[model samples]
Target: MKRLQQLIRYSTFALGLILACSFISERNQAGAVERPWKVRAYIQKHDFLAEALRQETGIPKAIIYAVAGLESDWGRSELAKNANNHFGIKSKPEWRGLEYCKPTQEYNGQQMVTQNDCFRKYPLIRRSYEDFGDFLMQSERYAILKTLEANDYTGWTDAIQNGGYATDPEYAHKLRGIIWRYQLTKLP
Candidate 1:
């Protein structure tokens, strides 16, 4: 009886350890994709940040939130999780700030391919948002976005893609879909 009890306790401890390890790894790796609820929760949780950033930068709040969803897969990417680089922004020669390099997927004309790239690293989510504002604001390519009405999310989407923010041909459509799905326009 004593031997049987010891064996049962050992099995339980091993099982618990396996479960705990798996949970941590999944969270550290897949994040929202592993837990479906995290995507939705991430969007909702950051709406206010998007709104404030919009007021500060003149980028539409909906566009900011939608881009966060489309760019980072609602904060599931490793950069988003580890570095708070929600926009998939890259390091530029002009930028002398901190950065994080990671593997990422991008459309290479015909198909998607993975490449290791360097992206801006922020210590906090808000810094990422603020930097996103500065990023676009400082770029001449994105200057056209300023002429469009602040609430014109569709136009903003087009401008972002046309400005070469993303290589994916469907970037605008995907961002629009994210906004519609989340009903982000309803946010103040």
Candidate 2:
């Protein structure tokens, strides 16, 4: 009986270790750096483009910056590097542009689900930022964001999550963490 309990405990520990390693490995494989400063530098380098988009579209650059950082690791991920898709905006059936498909993890209300999703592809990095702003501006699901005050990164973050821009329940929190961690709100 003692041996049976020991076996069960060992099995549980092994399963948990495996799952944790897989999760971290996948995140690392996505090209995110382990250091926070790298993300800040990356965001700074790309802020010019996101700032331009903000000016043209009235979307907060901070939100754009954080989402792009989280989704594509500031343009280092395979999807972003190969296809210029930094925002991870999936392709809809109506999409007529190029597409890139990859395995991604999404939340389906109750749990994390991994599936191959088709992402919108752009020919240029600037185009990707432009399309990302346009997506939030034109979609009714994100209409509420347009009404929020400019520079309200928190509000923008919340609305983006509630609008289903991402499936993770903690999507907004993660965005906010990055924004706060790197002082992204300091951006003018």
In candidate 2, which residue ranges exceed 4 Å CA deviation? Answer: 1-35
Query: Which tens-of-lDDT digit does each residue in 1-188 have in candidate 2?
Result: 99999999999999999999999899878854454676767776888998899889888767888899999987789999988999999999978999999899999996999999999999999889989988999999999987999878788899999999999999999999988776666676
For each candidate, the alpha-carbon lDDT, in order, equals 0.83, 0.87
Each prediction's TM-score against the native? 0.75, 0.78
The CA lDDT at 146 in model 1 is 76
> On residues 75-166, what C-alpha lDDT tens digit does candidate 1 reach at each position?
98788998899998888787687989878788899599999888888889998999889888888999988789977888899989999898
Per-residue error (Å), model 2, residue 98: 0.2
